[model samples]
Target: MDIQTLAARVDEIWAGEEAADARELVKQALDLLNSGAIRVAERVGGEWTVNEWVKKAVLLHFRYSDNREMTAGPIEWFDKVALKTNWREAKVRSVPTAIARYGSFIEEGAVLMPCYINIGARVGAGTMIDTWSTVGSCAQVGKNCHISGGVGIGGVLEPLQASPVIIEDDVFFGARGEAAEGVIIEEGAVLAMGCYVAGSTKIYSVPEGRELPPGRIPARSVCVPGALASRDGSHQTYAIIIKKYRDERTDARTALTSILREGI
Candidate 1:
């Protein structure tokens, strides 16, 4: 069936008080999966791409709106079918209410840490996802990474063409950092504490004497706090820079000052 039709059927099944045939629904959902008509749910910058059927199913299962409620049979049917069919990696902890759809990969030795991970989110091996960190739809993440507390990796599934957040290997995100608007954080880059990087934000290289305008950051560059000349020409709003840490300044006082300078 077409996406619209499938969506309508899903709505009908979810909205009604009666239960659906578990075997039949699973069979149809599997058919859509095999045909590539349905996909995992993911969002980027306020947009998401999802199978209409899955969307309706999720809404129905969650009792999402006041307009609808799911019958016990369908809910149980979905639980059994999803358990049997969904591909998920072995993890230490996961929310019983959370769902993993599509063919997204989550490798072993990685900890999910009880948060929602949408479809099309490729999580690398040995990655630790802390509390309240969202890996938005289609956000690709690399291996052995630490997504610290409250980090948001954006997804782009809507508009049918926008890119998602691509994070390369061995990166660290400080608390509450927002990387959205198809931003690409290259391998080995470290985002400092409380950095909110959006698509339109300017990224400057103080050490290289260059500027990156929107949706990009240079690879392997250490991003630390810096300053920009204010609009009123009075003071400067501190900014962040991806700079190289020189080893020549090994002296304790100089190192402390250098560290302190970046924070201010």
Candidate 2:
């Protein structure tokens, strides 16, 4: 079936309007997602559009499918979703212990190292998901991005309409950094080590001397973890401070060496 028909079927099933067998429809939608033909979300006309039907299909699939034993090398798993296994054909370079669920898409030239990428996540071309990083469901990672070691890119499946974390192109997320709750890290942003930002986290721009809207790290920004004084001056609350926009010096410091990505 075409995307439109598939979407309609899934939506009907979601609304308790379809009595037909849903397994095939759900599988078809998941197959499309696995092949990168459709995404949980996509940028359309400069805005990210959430495909609710696609997400519904994912949830429905969980209901329709049963847990099964799956193995890669000596490791084993029992889960409702199957792991992706077409790395060579997809032109993705995945190192040991890298696990991506069936519905996620890893574009060509991306490298995965000991990472866990949940269903509905997208790792863009030429990007590197470093060791111990977790890319949550429906999170959108852009091209040439560096998700550093131990970073947490949160995902959401509940409340159906909640936005996924969005990391735009050429971003350098430092080690142990965390971006959750639908945060949008704009293009070329360089987050310092250990920085954390959530939907309600205060983001202060030092140059502008003002607080930016929450959950958005501005384009080409250099972000560092900081704190602000409380009203009573008793303690400081965690915040992300934008030191400056990326420049030659910043680029030099955050540049991903070509040598590391040569094979990918």
Candidate 3:
């Protein structure tokens, strides 16, 4: 059956008894997402569009799946979702302790270092998800990026129509930084350590004190942590755009070091 028909069924029969047809449709939809034939969100005409129907299918699948026990060598897991496999065939370097659930896409040359990638997420080519990090459901991480240790790329399944986070190509998310709630890190941006950016988090430029749109950073921006005052004059944390540069071809490691050394 077509995805449209499946979506309609999900709308009618959701949260009720499990129907075989509904489960079948959900499985097919998940398979499409797993195969990278479809995505939960994508940039079209320079705008990010949320595919609500796809999200509904993912949610419905959870209802259909019951908790079960799974074993991997000496390790055992109790969960509703199945872990992703066949990394050798897919050309992905999923290290030990990396847990990627079914229905996520990890492209070729990507290396996952003890990370957790939830359903509907996509990790692009040559990207690295460092130790203990998470790529949340439906989040789209772009190519050749370095998501450093303990970083979180947020996911969204509730408010089913909401768009997930989008990290563009070549972004360097520093260690332990957290980004969530549909935040978009534009191409080639560098986020310094412990930065927290979300839809409500203020992002401002230093010296100029200009406020930028929340949840979206411009390309090539180097961001660090800072403090800003609320209406009551209480100091609160915000992301500071310390610098924005134009050299896209610069060495990422050297460029990041320069930004750190100059603190510019």
Candidate 4:
């Protein structure tokens, strides 16, 4: 079925309507997701558009499927979703302990180093998911981005209306950085290590001496963890400071070598 028809079917299933081929329909949606034919969210006309129906399909899958045992070498597990096993065909290089669940699309030329990618996520080509990092369910990461070690890119399934985290192309997310609650790290942004961003996290633009919109890191920004005094002048709270835009020096520091992206 085309995306339009699939979307309608997913909506119907989500509404508790019984379709004789409900499970099949859900499987088709997942298959599309796995092949990168569809995404839970994508940029259209320079704005991020969330596909609520796709998210609904993912939720419906959990309800319709049953958990079972799965084993990989000495690793035995029981789960509702299956792990992806097509690294060679996908042209993705995955180091030991790297795992990506079924229904996630990992484009060719990407490298996974002891990382975890959950269902409904889409990782673009030439990206690197570093050791101990996690690309959460439904999070959309674009091309040539670096998800550094121990970073957490948040995902959302419940509240079907909630948006998943979006990390655009050329982003350099430093080690231990966390982006959650539908926060958008725009293209070419460089986040320093340990930076945390959420829907309500304050983002102060140092150059402008003003606060930018919450939940968004502007393009080409160089951000770091910071603190600001509360409105009441009573206490300090965590914040993200946009120190400057990325420059040649910044690019050199965060450069992702082509050699590292090559070969299994």
The C-alpha TM-scores of every prediction are: 0.57, 0.96, 0.87, 0.98
Task: Kindly list the per-residue Cα lDDT of model 3 for residues 1-264, writing each as its tens digit.
Answer: 776776677666665745757777788888988988788888899888877777877888898788999997998889888888998888887889999999999987788889999999999987889899999999999988889999998889865537799999889888999988888899988888888888888888653458887879878777888877776877666555655553554453524322211211
Alpha carbon lDDT of residue 31, candidate 3? 90
Residue 256 displacement in candidate 4 (angstroms): 0.8
Candidate 4 CA-lDDT value: 0.93
Best by TM-score: 4
Q: Report the lDDT tens digits of candidate 4 across residue range 1-264.
A: 789999998999899899999999999999899899999998899999999999998888888789999987898999899888889999999898999999999999999999999999999999999999999999999999999999999879754438999999999999999999999999999999999999999999988889988989999999999998999999999999999999999999999999998775
**Candidate 3 C-alpha error for residue 207, in Å:** 7.4
Task: Give the true-structure RMSD of model 3.
Answer: 5.4
Sort by lDDT, top down from the best: 4, 2, 3, 1
What value does the lDDT take at residue 99 in candidate 4? 94
> CA shift at 48, candidate 2, in angstroms?
1.4
Better of 3 and 4 by lDDT: 4
Error of 1 at 211 (Å): 1.9
- After superposing candidate 3, which stretches have Cα over 4 Å from the reference? 2-20, 158-161, 207-209, 246-264
Winner by TM-score between candidate 3 and candidate 1 = 3
How far in Å is the alpha carbon of 172 misplaced in model 2?
0.4
